[model samples]
Target: MALGTIFQHDTTDPLAVITAPSPNESPEEKAAREEREAEARGISDLIDEELRAERAVRKKEEGMVKILLLGQGESGKSTTLKNFRMRFARDKWIEERASWRAVILLNLVRSANTILHALSQEMDDEQFGLDDAFTFDDYYRRYRLRLSPLLQGVESNLKRLLGAQPEEIEPQKQTHPITLSPRTSPEFFVRSRTWRNFLQTTRGPEVSGCSLEQDLPDIIDSTEAIANCKDDIKTLWRNDIVQAMLAKRRIRLEDSASFFLDAIDRLSVRDYEPTDEDVLRARLRTLDIQEHELRVDDDADAPKWKIYDVGGSRTQRHAWLPYFDKVNAVIFLAPISCFDERLIEDSRVNRLEDSLILWRAICSSKLLSRTILILFLNKIDILEEKIRDGIMVNRFLPSYGHRPNETSEVVKYLRQKFKDTVRHCSPEPRTCHIYTTSVTDTKTTAVTLISVRDGVLRGYLKQADLF
Candidate 1:
């Protein structure tokens, strides 16, 4: 370069003068500059280390399989989750088994109290006429009186202990106008995690410093009360008049998950232990999203798993969208047994129709379009029971159109309807596996779960090109 060009470049750029070392710099100035450079490097390395640690934790979580169970209320999402935990996380189940005793007792007391209220409603109804055959006479009055204290004492305290409350039954404007007496409402559902922690609280011999006398009275007294009333329970449940009253109101207590009325004899025993089947069948409505973790394979080589179970009620659905973005699979359960039943939240809407609408929304969700879709046409057992009792599918579902009312045919029809929804409504073509499941039946569900877990892992791995 020419001398004139070099001089011009040095004058034009002002930063060169500051960044360049002085021609006559002292040794002290050089040492200070080098020291500053070393400190900056140290700071930079610390930041890089923090970032690397955060990424490692995030990657580990992402590497594990994540499943979300989606469905409407009482569609067996909790039961399905229990199956996964029971099969893969047996140790946790075994540890928690004894704790479920209190829950089962609460369920029994709730059922008994419901029957008394129903009986009282008829007797108090002036419209039924004093001369009605199903009179709430002195004999029934004695049973009601006997059960009241036991029910009140255990029900309230127990519910408070477990952090749950009784659900209100409201009369809807659209459905048949039937007044549900407030006294007859017995469904107590968990509204908070306090009850979940109650399990741990009940596990040990004592709670805090309290003695067994001042102990969780509900836990101790429930069995004795229910046992003393066991004969009375059997009598009330088997009474023809009581049955007639419930039947006239179109209330089928037998069909609900919380209905353990039939097992009073076995359950009333002093040392009653809830069997595996009992735990799966116990119905306590989950109010919010519940997270469960399990190692799917044996500990030596198993991958971590995260399963999320969300409450399926209309109000709870708003919280579901955020979870749809990064899930491996979403198990959608539609209870076929509810074909003729109305939703508890809205009596005017048919439960089956609500499920179909929910399914359509899920299929159309852009966030879930890429997620694996697995449909469980759940509660086939109840569907078959209804059919055997002469319930015609076409009567409830007009479009069903005289197709044979057999369970296989009904399942096939519903399966196709869901399949078409995914095919047409989804943003893109995706694979959806449909399984006929009675999720309450743990044995049958075990097979379906294994097939689903393997299929989900393979599909997830294939998309990641890790297979």
Candidate 2:
């Protein structure tokens, strides 16, 4: 009876139609949306607080920890920095903390190149004409122009002497008359009384025409005669031109040396080709390398970090020694294929050797008395063959006793050798750890972490309270 009444009341009414909620529009969906919004807000607050706390901690750790990277030129220092930046971008710990400061990357090679380029520019700007041939008059003119400043007083005196004695002037033809007699005296035909007086005054008693008791007026004529001979005497002083040229040369040499030395002092020196343009280009390119400080807060109550990146270059190794004094940990980067035959054939082993030298140098530095070393075996993709084939062997041996074949055995040998080497450098052997990493990948590139002596690294970091 109830069903019949309902059908009769709204058989054709639109309100009588019943619909159910779609699967996506249920209460569960709304609850999930609310939960996500709450979680997002919570994360945002957490991140903001963490960043604030990290900044506060870093403020106290400024200039505390300095880490350096050292290797040969073109040994992937720039690539490593880029990879590090990418890691920071992807890592939740770095992203949430927002504690990184600016990254400062300096290239010594580029700096030296810049100074050389500037010198070249200065050389090009000099007024010295391109043509090699020069007339005597042109040479004399250049000599005078260059020496004008140095002989400014002498020039002024000469000008004043010529200006004060108006009576000494004569017709140009008379003053420089063409003489047939090679040894004729310039005063022979001085008929004017003034000229005669000038000759006597200049020639004095020692001259043939002058007497010991000659009066002042008679001596004036001799002075005129001597003045007439002044041009011949002036020709003898042209040797000063050589002095002026030497002065210019000295100036150029001194300026170039000073410029180069200043550049070296600022950026340090690195090896490279000697092409003029290559030097310039390298210097101009250095402006793009950036430097950054990495700070990490391990515990809320612990001290912060002021991390430094030493960059990669053999010369930069010396720079690392100073940083070790203040650092708690050292991240030593080693190429995965550094020990591989192909890498050696490609001459990349030279770079690895340079890196090892840096490590050895640091171990010997007094500043690193207690610093921990963490070896990062980068570019592990190429190392897979050696690891799988069990063909890895120790290439560096001191006693020359045993040859290693298996990868693990080779690694152990290396560890022992490195440990012994460090012991020689320090009273106590500093702890070291190893890790495998691959920074790049492509269709042709396959990288994997074959093996890592993580215990050694963990132990060091733990001892230093840096993990």
Q: Which candidate is the best by TM-score?
A: 1
Each candidate: RMSD? 7.8, 33.1
- Predict model 2's lDDT versus the native: 0.39
Task: Check candidate 1 and list the clashing pairs.
Answer: none
Tens-place lDDT per residue, model 2, 283-313, is 1112112344432333444333333545353
Whole-structure CA lDDT of model 1 = 0.77
Top-lDDT structure, candidate number: 1
**Per-residue lDDT of 336 in model 2:** 37
- Local error of candidate 1 at 305, Å? 1.3
